[model samples]
Target: MKPTLLAVAHGTRSAAGQRQIRDLVAAVARRRPELDVRLSYVDVQQPRIGDVVPAVRDAVVVPLLLSAGYHVRVDIANAVEGTGIPVTGTLGPDEVLLRSLTRNLPAADAVVLAAAGSSDPAWRESTHEMASKLQAHVAYASGSAPKVADVVADLRRRGARRIAIAAYLLADGLFYRTLHRAGADSVTPPLCLDPTVAGLVLRRYESALLTTAAGRL
Candidate 1:
């Protein structure tokens, strides 16, 4: 029997956000019906990772998160501890996500890559690297550095008109809504329901399975 592919995400209060995640999970299931794909959350929703991990006999936990921050390092690590189940890295800082971001982006004089920020320096750096690749200024909805609104205001001060915000989020929620009020002319949608994202989830699952197999040999 194949091990379960447990996709875990940071939960949101937004009903739309919840639906988007469910839809993304459905997309993954459609792509590979043979695999047992399940969904759980880390916060603000039911079926938290801690509760879900114990129920699965054998599985690989793939974080549906963009960066390796507090949730990935602490929350998930604590849940799967001593379970002998492998865990994959976060989904972003990858070319597949970059394509998704670029494809959704609209034309503007200035672009701000707005992310759900974290206190972890590594997370901040990883997000910065992605923003650098897109050639977009970096801002956060919360946690580290200059905020989304501040970046927009700064750009306006610098004579940039029609500034755009490229949402570096996996699903829409309060964070995405905040981007709309960030004083930008446009804000791209979150990276939800993108077929490429489904592909990336599969890749993470396969990669973890291979690594675990090699370790046993």
Candidate 2:
């Protein structure tokens, strides 16, 4: 049997957020009809990762997260432990994701990438790297310094005629909506349900399977 791909997301209460995740999963299904694609959540939703992982005898878990942090490192890593199931890295710091973000971006004199911040320096560093690649500023929605509003304001103060926010988020949720109020000229939508993202999902799944096969050989 082909290995199942478990697309795990950090769930949210917003209805839009739920819809985005469902649509994203559907896109993945469309891309790889040969594989069984399933959805599960790490938090704030039903059918948690722990419950979902055990049901599948052979699987690869791909986190629908921008960066590897608590959920990806601790929660997901533990969920598949002792099961011999492979888990792919989080879906950011990649050109595929950057393509989606840039495609959806609105016109502006300057753009800022806003993320759900983390205390981990590595996560922040990765986000910064992506920002540098995109030629955009980096700020956090929460959890760290130089918050979204501050970043937006500073860009404007520095004489940026128009400021835009590219939400570096997976789905529509509280953080997605909150980007608009960050005082930017415009805030793009979350990086969700795009063909590029679906492609990235398949790429991660295929690469992990290849690595696992090599290890066993």
Candidate 3:
């Protein structure tokens, strides 16, 4: 039997955010109907990682997070420890994500790649790397330096006539909403329900399964 694909996400209170996540998972399920795809959360919602992991006997935990921060390294790791259910890497710092961002990005003289920031340096570095790839400035909605609003203001001061914000988020939520008020001329929607996103999830799952099988051999 194929191992259950446990797609875990950072939950949100926004109804639209919730729907986007569900739709992303559903897209994955549709692509691979034989695989049992399940959805759960890391925070702010029901059937959290801790509760969901224990119930699945044979499964792989695929984090829906964009970066490897506390949630991926600490929260999800703690939940799946000793379960032998390997967890895949976060879904960012990849070409797939870059493609998703650019596809929806608005035209502008300057663009700020906005993310729901993290205290972890690794997470910050990953966001920066993605920003660099897009030739865009890096800004955080929370947690760390150079906030979205501040970046927008700075860009405007520096003579960027039309500034846009490329939201490096998984779904529409509090952070995405905040980007609008960041003083940018435009803000791209969050990354979810995109076919590339679903494809990336499957790639992570396949990569982890291969690694697990190789370890046994």
Candidate 4:
């Protein structure tokens, strides 16, 4: 049986948003040619997650979503629950991602770990440790007291020589745009259709489908 690999994305209205998901699909296809590769959005896009999952005969759902927020914990979960596909964790904020984020900072007096926040405390809380551990400044794009702007302000207050903002976004779009305007000396590139990220998706795909649950089919 060819285990399907669903590369699910949180969709957007921007042309770039759809394009990003397609680019991601192409990248995932390169690594795992044998598996069925499918793309779908969670909102404001075609082929919603509900529609995307059924197309895959049997598969593991990989939420391209950044954090385990209401979307992953509730929205996405409710969507795929009975489908019998084990969902993997969100792709960003992982240890591997920090490598790319830190690479953006050639030298940083402080850093803002910016993300598209969610009201879900679990999601928000998940990022705190990583942000604090970095030893640079930290903040979010969506929620909490020290937003990106405030974070940069706090850093400047401390007289940071250079401030580098790293986006926790899955693709290039509004969140990245907002993070830039939030007052920073510089920002890491928006996570785009990169090979490494695609590779990570493929890794999740392998583990999801090869495990006994996926094998039970």
Candidate 5:
């Protein structure tokens, strides 16, 4: 049986967000036709993690996220229920991701990282890592005090000649477009359904299965 590549996302009500997840799955399917490719959401969507894991009881689960958090460790945990399929890590701020951010953002400009803030400390730290990598001033919408606009204004106060807000996102969906039109200065193209990301997913799954196999010894 082929080990499945379950692409999980933090679900949203926006149809665009849901579509992004689907598109990512399609990209991965194209890159690695070997694995059983599928997608599931954490909330407000069908095929919850609980539902996706059982379907591929023998496949490794990989969160289509940039950082490890409750979804990767907790929600995904509950879904797998000790099925023995090694779970992979989140996909974000990777080498290509860093390149994407650097290439997208203008040099010498203050960057304001806009991410879907979370209550979890780990996730917050992960976001910080993503923001820091790009040499951008990090700001969160849900957890931190300053919104995207607030951060942009703060940069101006800091004597930034140009404030280029880079969306550290993986898709051209709501967060990307909404934050893109925020009138900061210029928001670069978001991480669309690209082959680089698909490769990351496939490699992560392979690593998970290898790790699971090693643990047996």
Candidate 6:
């Protein structure tokens, strides 16, 4: 039997943001109808990872986050520690995300990839790498320096009249509202609604499955 797939995320209070997360998980279910799928959050919501992981006998935890951070390294690790479950890597820095970004990128003289900043250098580095892949500037939505508004202003001063924002967010909420007000001419929607994102989740789950199988063998 395939292990249960627990789709974990950093929950939000915004109703729309909640719906986006649920819809994304629904999409994942559509991809593999036979798989038992579940949802939980690491923070700001109910059914927290600690509460959910212990209830499952065998499962693969796939983080819905796009980058690595304290949530991935500490919170999640602790949740599955004594449970002997395999936690898949966060869903990011992958070609699937790159495709979603490229397709959503608007026509502009310059583009800034706006991510939720992290204190972890590795987390920040992942966003920088994505920026490099898109040949775009990097800025933070919050929690770090070089805010999106500042990046947009710098682009304008540098003769970039048409600046776009590629919102590197998984769902809409406080961050998307802030990003839209960052003075960019255009801001693409969050990655949660992208069709490719669902596929990426499945790929991550499958990879974890393979790893689990290999360990058993």
Q: Count the backbone clashes (under 3 Å) in each candidate.
A: 0, 0, 0, 0, 0, 0
lDDT of every model, 2 decimals: 0.91, 0.87, 0.91, 0.74, 0.74, 0.92
* lDDT by residue for model 1 (107-141), tens: 88889999998889889989999999999999999
What candidate 5 gets wrong by more than 4 Å, as runs, is 172-174
Candidate 6 residue lDDT tens string, 56-122: 8678999999999999999999999988899999999888888888898878999999998888988
Please give the lDDT score for candidate 6.
Answer: 0.92
In model 1, where is the ten-residue run with the lowest total lDDT?
187-196
lDDT of 5 by residue, 1-217 (tens): 7767777877777676667677778988987777788888787678788876766756777888877777877788888776876678788657777776667777656778787667778877888887777777776545555677778777777788787877777665556666755557777665644556677778888888788778888
lDDT for model 5 comes to 0.74
- Candidate scoring better on lDDT of 3 and 4: 3
- Total backbone collisions, model 5: 0
lDDT of 2 by residue, 178-215 (tens): 78888888877778767678888888888898999999
Output the better candidate (3/5) by lDDT. 3
After superposition, candidate 6 runs with Cα above 4 Å error: none
lDDT of 3 by residue, 1-217 (tens): 6669999999999999999999999999999998989999989998998998877877999999989989988889999998889999889889999988898888899999999988898999899899999999999998788899999999899999999899999998899899989998888877885778999999999999899999999
* TM value for model 6: 0.97
Clashes of 6: 0
Pairs in steric clash, model 6: none
Pairs of residues clashing in candidate 3: none
